[model samples]
Target: MNMEDLTWGQFKALLLAHPNLHLQFKYAEDALVDASYHITEIKKAPITSVDCGGVINNWTEIIIQLWEPQGKMGGDAMKVEKALSIINLVEKALTLDAEANVKIEFGNSTFYTRQMYPSAIAVHGNDLIVDLRPDVTRCKAINRGGSCVTADKGEECCTPVKPKVQLIDLAQTNCCEPGSGCC
Candidate 1:
């Protein structure tokens, strides 16, 4: 998740407030998860990475995977109350970080399998829609005012410069003169 993304606490709070509403997930414009989608699993992952500036960064993410079984068709989405129950069940097994970023894992025949952040949660009629946005690639070093390369901002973060080499004219050397014995 990005710096401005919704956190796990925020997501749960929204669900709590709309317990009576049906939960619907929108991955893209006009692209929504099937009404029969299931909350297959919830994963808590801790990520540690070294950025280009050699800075160690750590974060946690709470990912909820949604799956719709094949041949399953038209039905109303699960109620927010049921989704909360699943969350509660997962909490019994592992402690979830409220501050962790939230992601939704889902895919169908048209959408690719990837984790998306909850950009917005809105009430549309009887449905509580979780609008998901794809996770984007970013340079942590650049975000922290450091450059990945010297050319980026005239500040070298990790890349090193290659030393310039000059060529020598071997034809001008005296080694072929036979030690000055005159070949």
Candidate 2:
């Protein structure tokens, strides 16, 4: 199933139902998280803000942070059942918004720290694969409306204009030169 189709709570419920399945994270086709990484923390962040154009926006996110043990022997990756247990423990302490967006935060010596969303989730054999996708900055005002200035149709708003520049050769004409109007 598409990860984008499922809410954070729905995804957690799915993981809980598949107790025997193993979990694997894929940042890209060739790059994958270490097999020893574990889910260290789950955070609920409620963000409210105004965009560059003064449009107010609000959203919530469930941030799942993953970490690999330091200097440890080879360890098996976290199992789906174990992950469910961790979620259950977290749910008891803090209420999680089921409709909130889900994001996974991960980093290592080779990979820079980033919070990415799951682009896709698939069940292959005994493993449940989560393909993480990076997020990009976007023009929120233009997205929410037609233009940053107004939502009216056929109206041009905030069109970029090239700055006018004048260039003069100092060698041919200078302020210090004769009859150059220097004090």
Candidate 2: stretches off by over 4 Å:
1-6, 72-75, 151-183
TM per candidate comes to 0.83, 0.77
In Å, residue 11's CA in model 1 sits off its true spot by 0.9
Candidate 2 local lDDT, 1-183, one digit each (tens): 556545787888768777887888888667767778889999999999887665689989999998866653444566899888899999999999999989999988777889998998778778788889987777777886566664544434456546786666667777677776443
Residue range 1-183, candidate 1, lDDT tens digits:
443367889889889999999999998899889899999999999999997666799999999999977876867899999999999999999999999989999998878899988887889999999889989898887877544653446657666657887654666766466664333
Q: After superposition on all CA atoms, what RMSD does each candidate show versus the true structure?
A: 5.5, 5.5
**Any runs in candidate 1 off by more than 4 Å, and if so which?**
1-4, 146-154, 158-183
Per-candidate Cα lDDT values, in order, are 0.86, 0.79
User: Whole-model lDDT for model 2 versus the true structure?
Assistant: 0.79
Candidate 2 TM-score, C-alpha based: 0.77
- The TM-score, computed over Cα atoms with residue i paired to residue i, of candidate 1 is 0.83
